[model samples]
Target chain A: MSDKLISLLSGIIFGIGLVISGMTNPEKVLSFLSISHSWSAEYKWDYSLIFVMGGAIITAAPFFYFLKNKEVSSLGLKISLPAKQDIDKKLVIGASLFGVGWGLVGFCPGPAISAIAVFDPIVLVFLVSMAVGVLVKQNIIK
Target chain B: MTDFTPYSALVGGIIIGLSVVFYFFTTGRLAGISGIFENAITNSVNRFSNLFFLLGLVVGPLLYYNVIAPKVSIAFNITDSYTLIILGGLLVGFGTRLGGGCTSGHGICGIGRLSTSSIIATVIFVTTGMLTVTILQQFGIYL
Candidate 1:
């Protein structure tokens, strides 16, 4: 099949998995990260978060295997991976900010967008600001 | 919604992993969150790849909620909504551009592929996450 067809199929499957797994629920995510959550209190120690992560790992196994044999792209061009390997100022500062936002809101951009499907206003604001931020960083500043 | 299943998490993770692999298979892309966003904005990489990758990110949850399960509750303090909207937006966007990717780019796709930049990036992401949580706690902010 064409690349677009494959991506659409992949996206549908992924969306179904997210809904089935309850990763869309920020409460579940927060409780999983914390030892003490009223939600977790009722729910048996659900480390399914790890499983979701693990599932992703398992799914990518084939890719790794392929990489082992074919480290370079098929087109005979060098893989354009990032070259800089330093823990520079940019990484430190940005990660700090991301972590703060993630901790406080229990919503990252991925899940935040999903929350929009649930009609959550908070997520809408997040989406708007995030889009604006992207614009500012790419366009206005540049 | 108290439909509890431990196996689902495993399945979910597997699905994510598979998606990453699929991403690479079709697009020759690494499935890095930051890279996807960058492509979306810059219009340099394949627009189709960016659209589909982002679509997966969004649809992943919708399918889970509507089809697989019935109810999902998320407890968020509306009082902090404004703060979250502004600061979180600026930080993540700035971080992604500056660091060249997000957690997925560094933590999952980057580390998995054994990229040095991803390794350093992951460390910074984790360390900053810890520090941010600590600072928030110190200020008597509970979320």
Candidate 2:
């Protein structure tokens, strides 16, 4: 099998996994983040988010440990693990903006893309806008 | 209705994580979404890496749903889909380019590869998510 084929398949599986895990649902995610307004009337702080994050970590932990000991390329590009650890203004500002955006929308790129399976116009719009954003930042803004 | 199972997530996550490992072992690659996507679209790198990465991502959920319990459902307001999606898209797109990767790249791949840059990027992504919620709530838009 070709690598491209495998990548595409993996992405599809990843999307399906997101859907099953309720990662695609912004409400569930938002509730997971802040229990104050979760639709679950009798909700305490939802630990589902922790589970999901933990799930993601557990899923990758072993391999990561193995890879940590080696020098390997990633996605066909040589991995460059940065040495300088500086939290500059750009990092802070960017992270702040990103958090605000995520909190408001309840969807990130990963889950949002998976939501395409729902065939909702809103998801379509989100994806288009996202692509346009990428285009602008990459081309127009540059 | 039983409460959610934290361990289920563990199982699912382990599967996904192992998939990432398998991806690396087989293709000698890291399963970073943005990087794989960038290469796929730009045709800048080997086409195989991009293909398998995307494939693993797509198929992962199907296997989980079929083999694992299928009670999980994604719940969200569909009414404001357009506005939310558009806003989300723009922000993510901009962030990915500015920070140089998405959550998967930094959070999953970068963290796995032990790259400081990936760690920084992941922090930015998480912080962004948190802040987005706070600001939206302040403006009464999060609802």
Model 2 chain A: lowest-lDDT 10 consecutive positions: A76-85
lDDT against the true structure, per candidate, is: 0.61, 0.60
Given the true complex, what DockQ would model 1 score? 0.42
* Model 1 Cα lDDT, one tens digit per residue, B28-140: 66666656666776686567856776776666666655655557543233325588557876677666666667655666676676667766766665555546545654676
**Over the stretch A1-142, how does candidate 1's per-residue lDDT look in tens digits?**
6656666566666555555566666555544444333244654544555566556655675576667455455434344555655776766666666665555555555566556667767777776777676666677544
User: How much lDDT does candidate 1 score?
Assistant: 0.61
Highest DockQ, which number? 2
How much is the lDDT of residue A50 in candidate 2? 55
- The 10 consecutive residues of candidate 2 chain B with the worst lDDT sum are B1-10
Clash count for each candidate, listed in order shown: 15, 56
lDDT of candidate 1 at residue B44, scale 0 to 100: 61
Which stretches in model 1 have alpha-carbon errors above 4 Å? A32-51, A68-80, A139-142, B1-6, B70-80
**How does residue A11 of candidate 1 score in lDDT?**
63
